[model samples]
Target: MANPKRYTDDCALGPFSTKSQKTLSYIFSPTLWTPLLFLLMAAPPSPSSVSAELRTSGEEAVPTEVIGTLGGFMTLPLNISVGTEIEHVAWNGPQKTLALASPAGAVIILDKSYQSRLSISSQSYSLNISKLTPKDEGLYRAQINRKNSNITIEERFVLHIYEQLQKPRVTVKHTMSESTSCNLTLVCSVERAEKSVLYSWTWVDTHSFKSFESSTLTISWMPCDPDVAYTCTAKNPVSQSTSSPIHAQQFCADLRASRGRTVGETVVGTLGESVTLSLTVPVSRDIEKVVWMFNTSIISKDWREPAIAGPLMKSKEPGKDRVWVSDQDYTLKISQLKMEDTGPYNAYLCLNTPRLTSTQHFTLRVYRRLKKPEITWIPGPSDDSICRVTLMCSVEDSGDDVTYRWTFLQKGAVASQEGSLLNVSWRSSEYHPNFTCTAMNPISNSSWQFLSGNICPGPSRSMKHWIILFLITVVLLCFGFSGWCIWKQKRQCSAPAFNSSQVEAPADLSGQDASSSEERQFIHSVLLCTETPTGGTTTATE
Candidate 1:
């Protein structure tokens, strides 16, 4: 007691610390405390603990809700490895129960009413259930433990049971129009989940077909005809089900009305241009195949014939409406549009129905257009003098409606007259060869505007002689006028001198002397006339 009073605050093991004391207590009570601590550390975490911890997949523990598929998974923190193995998995209630063990492969299944125990290895731990029943529904719990770590996972799955399934319902998804094609889809679904279902598809016709899927039916093509129907039926071993009359009748009426194929729609196009017609046939019965016939001839006939342009015929099936169908829109384009090309045509298709046909009428009119005429020169006069340049105008295209006019241009004057011929005096020097004639008709007119080639003389030889005669006649008239003027002047000079001498002698003498003198003067004048040469030309001396 006296030695304890000397104790220092710096003692190796202080009295205030509980670490060493707690360690000593654990060592002394190993039998009771060791097992409790091990249990505490190895116990599966509670749902609250798992939920409260915020974690990412790689950084924290794996959640129990997300159990890996059939394969084993490695969780985070590799030091704490955990996995499970089981021989079989079974269900006991509305939800299934699962139990598994680690490494040892020991397995046990417990339902509300049944419990089973088994051992399994990793290779044989997975169990597959093909069909699920109401009794299979139960809670599923799997436990895995390794070393000091353990994991427990729970999954809840509900199983549904069905009584019987109704047949699938189908309806037209697209509207019916002559110019357009429509599509249809059938939906087959049951209100309750069923383990096994048998599905079959059939039409109003005698044909039968089937489907592998649950209870859905579909028809891609539907026509506006009124005699075809589509039907579907579904069944199981315990019970058989069919679609309701309301839903069935709706599709039935739609398909039933689609009896004839459309084959092709009415089409119009320009002359010399072609058009393709599409033909559709709606049939209540199954179609073997489609055969096409143009008019009375087979499709193999030559397309060059006019009959190919005619209406085609389609033979109908035994139970369907007559189908007149054409791949072409009842169209025939003429190589050249002619009045005869216009007519009625038939487009026909060969369907299950007997003979069905459609007709289209085409009216073709051809127009006649005027073409320009060709011209050639006719042979006539050639050359300026001895040969005259004569332009012979004629039309290459002679017709009843044609008319002609002639025109001439010379010496700064323009004169036009109607005829096929024109004549002008030839001038060798300074002459213009601008002659032209035009031919016209009520419909068209053409001029020889560019016909001015070489203005050479044509084939005439009489023009030179006619011009020479005209020159000779003018020269003769000029010489005759000069001779007449000289004769008239000599007679005037001789008469004036004789008249003056007679007047002076008559006043001075008696009547005898006057008479003798007048007689002598008259005698001398007569003698002068007598002595003058008869043929000699005379000149007046004044």
Candidate 2:
């Protein structure tokens, strides 16, 4: 049996208080250095100065910090030195004992609540739990000891649980009122407001993009670099997601668009349909990275050059198998699309040969299939041989952004207009017998045909009235034109000419001439329409 004396103890401890004695006691009692060893099992941490200090002092381990995703699995690593044999180990979670290992190298799970989820490794004594929940988050501890030894070695961990981070949005706008300025203000945000999220911005530059450690970034446009692309990443304790790369090549040139959403390609897709975000450019040997990103996640990427293998389809989001990128052209294709798949999608390209970068941005819109359209027509009264009817077109389930168009089915038919209402006008002979109205949206269209004879039968009933109207108008215009010509003829003959000189002529010829010339022609002598002389009832013969 070894003596239980150590310089660390108070009255009960018996030992030489010198440096050698204290060192020997610390070396034997594994509990004294357990904290220092616990840190090694944790996930890698940010760079810190304490690493060197801990190395030199060799006193304590850092508190183990483990982050587990919700509904995921995590293993609390049991970091042990080489050749250290464990007789048995016990695992404890927030509430009570989770599991234990028998000296015979068998795992025995305790806590009935975690019976289905908890498992312990017989050799290393590591604790693993699956399908983690919020209640699983808290402190966890493991105690181990060798056979016939009083010293107990232990490790502690603080477990943090977080759900997947939401997709982030990046809004771009000009900070200045002047439309000419290229200065831009970009803001990055997630759909849900979370406190523990870390945001970083990686933008396209002459070389590989340099990342900024903030949610917002301001930039001064330099004329030399005409095109610039930016991508934002949001990270939680468990996972990280990147935003779609927004190509801002036009943000400076098209100042009018700088104040609203950034300019990018917009694509319309129907729900459950497939769409391919095509990358038209060929892959160059000097290609640095070809990344396909959704709203806040990278669905796929091709990072390897000649040395690297084929494109690694690494997507952590749900329904990841539905997304794929082509090795030949780096085109991204998505199948069985859902609502969450609708967002900004980017195809980012970087080439190291000339130190250049380019990106294509696409905004995907998903819509349900359009419903069937209905056409209703109201016939108006015909006047002066003109037929008029108003046809209103409507869709049953359409809400907004719906457009309407009208087409004439009748050959050589000229009657057609667009809107919710279609105005139809035709002469008695020129009526459009068949017309179709179509209701459409971005994704789908439905058309309804309107047969004029079937819908509006009033054309036959009103046809006689139009024919009579046409005859009456023609008779009145002819009467007016004839009266004007007759009045002008009478005015020219009403003036009489007198000659005072006597003349000699034969008796027979003279009478014939006098009767022919003296009997003046009269157009309407009974009612000399509207002309009255100054003297009353005076008649003169010439």
Candidate 3:
């Protein structure tokens, strides 16, 4: 409904057609002053005039702040109204003109300093400077002109360039402790810093996952809280950097409190027996809750209500049916204790009067009763007068803590020794010749008696007597055989002489030969008894 010609003319001015210009001149020539007035009103104001007016209105040509890092890129923003027609754009800096763009959109470098370093965005007419240095930090101005109009708009930017922030180094100053709390001081610093840098401290509570921040921090370490970690950050206009985290636990090594104290008790019982782990809370405070733990697992919990007269006990698995806690003193009793139960048992008590907690740690040791020991003698040199023996005392399936003790009774005197093996030299005596060996442990003890006679028995007395009798019989038999041999030799020598005389007698004499033979035999026996005649000088009384 409105005339399009007036709308186009009010927004922008472009090259007019020849017919339009001739028609405008003929109409305006009727009044010579009208042509000049129309020309004057159609032209816009000059750039210098517009700039002066903007300055008089207290308008800022440049941005108030711009951040840039050293050796990095930075952009100066420029804003233009929509549907504005631009004829030329120019960028200027402190010492020289930077760039120029013509109405045809051709950009030309005007300064050698920014020949390759300047860029302009077609969308927003923003100027980008690459590889910025500290020397490039200054105010930059952008100027733009409308087509066929003398009016110009200007924008300015103030760039501040700085080096990237370096990582901060954190150091612990010192640690001091008061009566109930500990105070720690720490310092954070950066090397070769030229710009204004801010230091901030941040810490995280590991237990709660909550975070806190401050310019500086001093910790008041408490006994009940877990470890805390803190980090330091150094930030500048250009960049931000963080240091390595440090923990408060590292500084409070010796200040930590003990959780509980250990009380070692040796409980000795026979196999297949029940043992009670006794615990008594002091009468100074009223017991509100009691808990029993085996190793690290909770085995039993006992609690009493405000109006109840007895405590309600709850037992967990693995020890549910076999464990019992007394209501009076809260002592734990284990039925049929096993070897696997030989570990640490803890009892925790909560009191109501002063609201205090007490923990008692018990190192329970369950042992099996020792069986009767056996005493055996190791063989050694022995004689009739004295005997040396080595006796070994031992028990089957015994623990390493068992000890061996030896007791000997010799010649009305008692001597004892403690070891696994005992060496003894025994002499014949009228007193009981025996010794006792005992194997003992904390749980139980057993002893065995060893008879010295059996331990080192001399050669049997009966055996010695039989050996002597056998030797005497052998000697008698040898002597008798020698006498019989001598007598037989003498008989042989005499009888041969008599036979020789008979052999020298005649070959024939039958009837009257008896007296002759007897006479000859008698004569021969006489000759033999005497001596043989020398050279046959027989007394022949013929």
lDDT per model vs. reference: 0.38, 0.63, 0.63
lDDT of 2 by residue, 11-70 (tens): 111111232234446644778578646764574443332442232233543447777888
Shift in Å, residue 507, candidate 3: 50
**Of the candidates numbered 1 and 3, which has the greater lDDT value?**
3
State the lDDT at 86 in candidate 2: 65
Lowest-sum lDDT 10-residue window in model 3: 1-10
For 1-542, candidate 3 gives per-residue lDDT tens digits of: 11111111111111222323344444336666576567659987566455533632325332445777888998877666555677777888756778887645578888887878888877567788999877888766676666754445555556778888788887765454643245667678788777678888877665455434544666765322334678888888768899888765445432322223346564554456788878867976777677565542344444542211111122344334556667777877776666766666656676767766677767767777889998877767867756666778889988657998877656643333548888777553333367888888887899888876665544445678899999999999999999999898678567646565554353344445355667676665545544556645344222
lDDT digits (tens) for residues 61-145 of candidate 1: 2322211111122111111113323323222222333333334445454332333222233443333332333444322222222
Q: What is the TM-score of each candidate against the true structure?
A: 0.23, 0.37, 0.37
Which stretches of candidate 3 lie above 4 Å from their native place? 1-64, 81-87, 94-96, 104-111, 122-124, 145-152, 162-168, 178-180, 189-213, 232-244, 254-542
RMSD of each: 24.2, 23.4, 15.7
Off by over 4 Å in 2: 1-62, 79-88, 105-108, 145-151, 162-167, 173-176, 190-197, 205-209, 220-225, 235-240, 249-542
Q: What ranking of all candidate models by TM-score puts the best one first?
A: 3, 2, 1
